[model samples]
Target: MALAVTCSISISSSSSSSSTFQSSQPKFSQIASIRVSEIPHGGGVNASQRRSFVKPPQRSRDSIAPLAATIVASDVAETEQDNYQQLAVDLENASPLQIMDAALEKFGIHIAIAFSGAEDVALIEYARLTGRPFRVFSLDTGRLNPETYRFFDEVEKHYGIHIEYMFPYAVEVQGLVRSKGLLSFYEDGHQECCRVRKVRPLRRALKGLRAWITGQRKDQSPGTRSEVPVVQVDPVFEGVDGGVGSLVKWNPVANVKGHDIWSFLRTMNVPVNSLHSKGYISIGCEPCTRAVLPGQHEREGRWWWEDAKAKECGLHKGNVKQDAEAELNGNGVANTNGTATVADIFNTQNVVSLSRTGIENLTKLENRKEPWLVVLYAPWCPYCQAMEESYVDLADRLAESGVKVGKFRADGEQKEFAKRELGLGSFPTIMFFPKHSSRPIKYPSENRDVDSLMAFVNALR
Candidate 1:
């Protein structure tokens, strides 16, 4: 059976060592090279200190495991429901170290810490103190800051552990870039980019593990993450066994405050990203993250361009009621209750609604010897709504030109056609299909005005 285990850790002044193993124990030469006193205290390594370390050699794409190779079969017995409940109760108020110890002992090599930012490195420190064989991995989104990649190398060397780097599928990434361009997320949303870059790679990484750990805290985003439990079954991800109920997710620092994590990092001398010293709190892809002002929350630095409520990137959104597909589609349309109906889109003037059959009929347009303009849009999209007046005006003005203008509301029944066949990654995507051509030319101008739309089609003719 597939099971997803999620647990939280509280911050408390407890014993630092989760095991009898001492940091002074010299097993690996790399670990012995740095003395405990050499690590700076109270904060992360300053800019000068960080630059002192030599950069590690970079690995090639062939050296990293493919997504399919990461899925390992599992034979671990499932934890009884009652026992699992007790485990949660026991760790509810436990210190981060204690929580880490329990997880490391139970899952052993089958569990890994999903290391990314400073908080995750703190978890790495805690895992090191446990003295047991543990695993660490990072999702290489291929768009991360150079400093972040250097930091990953630093952590691996500092902790004397091998960190498996997971990457997104090359084909999916190429397809997204070829169709939408490299920076389409700026126009639409970050969800699609994140899905191709982070979420899918994480899914592949988790496929081989019975449990994984994160550094999520309830206090990070009070609006979205306030209810994070100290320990519970993960409702979203499956485990290494490939069964429906076998994987466990551990958020050891779920109850730990941000300051407390920094303190742990400082006290333990964990390696951290240099960007942290520059004021970036919550780090993701380089393009999406920024340094926040003194009063702003850490999460504010991530995806700051979008609405505050829509900050998540889908990794932690499995249980949330938000429309996963719409978010990934980057249509800027929320699938809340009472969403706009098909009539709302069809009622507009100069707009022809296209159904599945209607889309199929478009092939006949190739024979009609008439260039046509079409928009794949979602009715609830604010951008699509804003373009309505201009679009209608453009259609009416172009009627005498013998160029057909139409739109497809990519919602409900027609979503599949828009997404799969048309490759509609974002809403209000205007395309001009020339007569006798199956390939449609995308609207080239960023300015969504009637004149601009007319100029595009007129130039084509």
Candidate 2:
């Protein structure tokens, strides 16, 4: 439960920035100047001390330039960074209700739960259980299912709380539709469409708040969300503060399982999306979601046409950690010369790093002593990163054999050439160079696990 203490913290704002909330509600400019503080953890301060901590200096006429807004934001982030990190550590194993309590306590009404109109309704339930004042918000992508829209209304009626709806800019949506049909995502990829409809609107919504809670669970997507922490500084989107590390993200149910979430909802008699009963395990926009078959993982229903390893809709880019791909020249400094440094995974002894010239020479197959197996990959690609461990293990197992295991960096300047000749339609394209034929055979399956890759190598060799 939230501590019984009250104070005030002021959020910085601009004159023209409009409220994402309903028109009947006051504009952001009106409400942004003052917020009630619900005691943060062990700390309790009267209204004066609270003002000293978070309330920015008073600006005349409620008009601050963008540059001034940025400075104010930077100060707030620096002041709260260490405290939030410690808070995250302390709440590592805390229950969803407890974490939600802490979030509500710190940010108060300045924080809002990002309700996804799906299973994320559990977050609202947790907040209600905490008996704390909370705000709820959702992105209206204009493409959600009719059932999901109805469920949104049902949630509003059940909770008696208004949901602030964020929408994409009209011109942007029109531009995308004019250039390409509504279903362009089906032909190319979902990222562009999702960026315009969901990610941008969510970004706009978050920019008006100090913190936001999410429904992310570690078990939701093995490739992307497995390491979700209970609390952390958001790595992707900025908040009202508007800078890197300026936003605090709470994943109260990060440690919880999907089955457990459903159980809690059932036990509490919480309302759920009607689509859940129809087997839509992970519901999203109408076109992107579907009913899964028995025993299939929930996320398999989302973006089913794309690689499962890269299923995120870009709302939580922070969850996709790419630190392993950081380029450093042994001393964390870039090489003075024009050469790009390769990551350690590409430099392993068992897996030879093949340059474009080396790959071209191998294609000749003249006086070749051993067959070569190589993966054309880009380090930045999530699918490529996902299979790195398995690929390295397969290379280690093949080290004794005469076959040469190698990797060719096929992105950046080399991407077009790779597509033309090396069958590089996507990241981490695997090809086998046989002993006799110059033609390189492509690995046909999406299964990139160690056992499956080893079997493919063994059969080909």
Candidate 3:
């Protein structure tokens, strides 16, 4: 069973040859006034104010930054010569949290960063040294093995930075468990588990945050080759604000890739993960991790069985489906900031940040008689294309008429199951699943263009 890489929104840009859209960002916010960051000296702000990011010098064909830590300001300067010294000092000795705090103090916003393993320790050390707590902190979806945990503990002790965790929402996890338990991920392979645990958590963790950072590097993967300075919109970060909001992700270690991270630790005199000396090129949760052998890419250890398509755990590199209703339309996207738009509702890149900690609604959703049409379309499917705007419009009309409308996508590896349960005949299919009913009322294969598609959807019982 080939795990066909599909996107919920397509990012049609200069680079479309590959299905996966690299994490390169095109920020639209002002450098000094980024929404979530607060920098005292010179970081800009606002939705349309992010053009001053002085991107690091490109190393090679590869150079993707992480969502965990973004470059809030590229050209920050208190004094020309003094600012240069400050940046140099930041690069030389600053904790991950310190870097984040400094950016926030300067830019007036928050940021994000992820920990694959010990490499995160360096980020932590920087945070500790500079007394700057990170804006966002997370771990991958795969289960972490003992060694990795031990190393994490060691780093916490060494740097005293309490790393925050981001996981998938329990509601979805329970839903998955009701359908398939923990072992189901193994049977379903990487993508399904990634979607349920990793991707969903990242989505929730990043909700409402302004800027996100990552520990990503283009050299890490062949897929991340054509990275750019700033991206206006991306497929993976769909359904969120402007989709082109400022990305304050900073790769302090961009110049450092494929090198011995553990060796660097020894040089820095940092406590190292004992296992690094062995062969663990990439360190993440244990269940889905392993040690990369010689003559292999760093990521070769992560889900060695799956192809590049299945390797992603969802939070980092995934597809985008832009054809759906614009997240801004329909019932009207709620006004959050002064400059609210459809992009923020959907394609915003802040990954899942689970709140309401320990409080979960376990009760199953009691089927209701209210009419609804659950959409089961892949981001890559053409049928679901351009359906977002119509859906939002329909949602708007329904709300005005006192009707409830909802959306659901057939993402991950379970589309086959959806096809079986919903009797899907083609892509971009929308089945009317009325409330109080257990199954969906299948629609016929008819005119699918915008005109009839909305009409058929409007007539759902």
Best by lDDT: 2
Candidate 1 local Cα displacement, residue 278, angstroms = 0.7
Error of 3 at 274 (Å): 3.2
Cα lDDT tens digits for candidate 3, 324-385: 43442211222234333323111211112111220011011346535554455544332243
In order of lDDT, best first, we have 2, 1, 3
Measured with C-alpha atoms, the lDDT of residue 37 in candidate 3 is 29
User: Residue 206 in candidate 2 has what lDDT?
Assistant: 73
For all predicted structures, in order, the TM-scores are: 0.55, 0.60, 0.45
| Candidates' RMSD to native | 16.4, 10.8, 21.3
lDDT by residue (tens digit), candidate 2, 107-178: 655578888899999998887766555778888899999999999998876776667777888899999999
Per-residue lDDT of candidate 1, residues 1-461 (tens digit): 33322222111122321212222334421222222223233334332111110112122233222322322234233432223344565567877777777776555545678888555788877776665546677888999999988998876656555577888999999999999999899889998999999888887777666678887888777546766765555557655445444566778788898998888788876667999989888898889988864324577678766654467787787434454544333333344353642224424555666667776678445565677788887665444555677888888998788898888776555667776777665555787888878777787544667787888988886
Kindly report which residue stretches of model 3 are placed more than 4 angstroms away from their true locations once superposed. Answer: 1-105, 129-136, 140-142, 185-187, 225-235, 238-247, 260-263, 318-461
Off by over 4 Å in 2: 1-81, 324-461
TM-score of 1: 0.55
Q: Report the Cα lDDT for candidate 1.
A: 0.65
